[model samples]
Target: MEGQFTGADVFFVLLGAILVFAMHSGFAFLEVGTVRHKNQVNALVKILVDFAISTVVYFFFGFAIAYGTSFFVSASELSGAGSSGIFEAKGLTLVKFFFLTTFAAAIPAIISGGIAERMKFAPQCFATVALVGVLYPFFEGLMWGGNFGLQGWFESALGAPFHDFAGSIVVHGVGGWIALAAVMLLGARIGRYTKDGRPIGIPPSSVPWLALGSWLLCVGWFGFNVMTAQSLESISGLVAMNSLMAMVGGILSSLVIGRNDPGFIHNGALAGLVAVCAGSDIMHPIGSLFVGGVAGAIFIYAFNLAQNKLKIDDVLGVWPLHGLCGLWGGIAAGIFGSTALGGMGGVTFASQLVGSLMGVAYAFAGGYLVYGVLKATTGIRLSSDDERMGADLAIHKISANPDTDIMR
Candidate 1:
């Protein structure tokens, strides 16, 4: 029985890792469909390469920083066969690393969407190394790994510690806020607005492709949220049901609020999923519905405000969708996870608010620091000529559809 459980845990975590890994394609396609056709190939290439870099960096440095464990030991110790006892008996620790590394890689994947079209490739890669290796893991350790006694302090002051069942704040919120800093540093894409400061409409290259990306994300998110349990015995049907309810809630709200705009409708689903990540394990399905509905509406309105009113030019609205909504998710977990709200309880509003805000502030500051340094040193944006030429051709030396260009 012990051996059976050990193997099951490994298989479960491994499967979760694969599902989350596949979501990188979702990120790539989402950016591809949102950016112009000329820059589509760059979008795809950036996501794949970012994942590769994130995996390597997180393996070498980020994991150790977050968990205070290193893989520098011999194979026997790593596989739990040695006297260290730091790892599980059946290689479960290694698979756990694979699972969490997928989560870490998501930081760069989220930023890729915001900084698309004009970012220099090498500088962005450098930024990824800094973020995944240092900044993200530091915060991750504080919240999840109990580093610096912050979680204990929160519990002492607020009567409860922060609870992010998944990574609404840790992954999405941090990613979104950091992307905000990068977007500000990069400025609006060329010609995104006129000299008079009025916004210009740059329509997506392919709506179908955009829809496909959303579909892929929605499907994979189940694995993302549910598998965070990391073991078979801890799985919950409640999380799965809440995720489904929230997804539809987002879809329905976006459909109405966005007035049938396909882009809004699809992204609405993501907004709900993002918000529900922190509370899915505890919230009732109905409560999850309201949380998701609100998140869907928030994305539509905030996205419009960011682009039209504020001139932020976050290409994919990642700030609103991930940053703001993820913040809301962290707080909502406190509200919707209460026993008074038909939830399982064990969360507090004050702690959630403080923790969520802390994540946002940290991410924004770290983003500016890292990107600011890179801006001063290596430079993060392409030159004017390169920007005009499109990243696909300028950076990769080929257009997305080469044969079609030749025929033209």
Candidate 2:
């Protein structure tokens, strides 16, 4: 019976890993549909390659940094057959690594959208190595793995450890804020603004593809959130319900607030999901709805603010959708997850705020330092000629539709 239970746990986490892994396709299609046709191929390729890189790096380095686990052992030992006891029975640890690697890889996938058209591919790949292997795991250790006693400190000082049921701050917030630094360093895609600094509109190549990306992400998010429980015994229907309600809330608010703009409406769904991730386990369904609504609005306003007022030129508005919304998710967990707000309790607003802010600051600083150094050394942006040609031709040496280009 114990053996059967261990096998079931392995299968559960493996299924969750597979589902979250599928979200990379969602990320790819989302970027493919958002960027100009000339850059679509590059977008797809980057997501896949970045995932590969993230897998290798996390297996070798990042996972160890976070949990102090090492996979460099005999297969028997790794499978708990050799009595090392370093891993769980039935290879559960391996599947857990698979699940977490998908989360770690999401950092580069998020950054890929922001720097899409004008950044050089190699530098971005190097940035992925640094981010997944070091910067991101450093924080993951602090928050999730209880490294350096940070969560202990939070409990001691603030009456509770920071509560992120999923990776609202850890994954989405870190990725989004890091993307902000990359976008700023890469500067605006050429002609994205007029000489006088007025914004120019660049319409999406295909709205259907954009919608498909959102749909895929929305579907896979169930696994991303629910599987955080890491065991079938720990699973909660509440998490699934809150995710659905929050997604609906985001959709409705963006529909109204964004005046039915397809871009805003699609991304608003994502915004809500991103925000609710932290508190989904604890918050009431009603609180989740409001949180989702607020997140949807935050994405609309903050995207515009970053693009227009701040002139950040983040290509897919990743900073707003993930960074700011993720930050909100972290803090919202405190408010909405509190007993006062109909939550399961054991959370504090101060802890959430500090942890969320800490994530943002750390990610931004790490992003800037990594990309800034890359820019100084090998350079991050493409040449003006490549910018004009688009990333497909400039980097990958082929257009998304070569036959169509040939006809032209």
Residue clash pairs of candidate 1: none
lDDT of 1 by residue, 25-132 (tens): 899889999999988999999999999999999999999999998999999998889998898888899999999999999999999999999999999999999999
lDDT, candidate 2, at 108: 98
Question: Candidate 2: deviation at residue 191, Å?
Answer: 0.5
What does each candidate score in C-alpha RMSD?
0.7, 0.7
What pairs collide in candidate 2? Answer: none
- Model 2: weakest 10-residue lDDT segment is 77-86
After the best TM-score superposition of candidate 2, give how far the Cα of residue 227 lies from its true spot, in angstroms: 0.6
Lowest-sum lDDT 10-residue window in model 1 = 82-91
TM-score of each: 0.99, 0.99
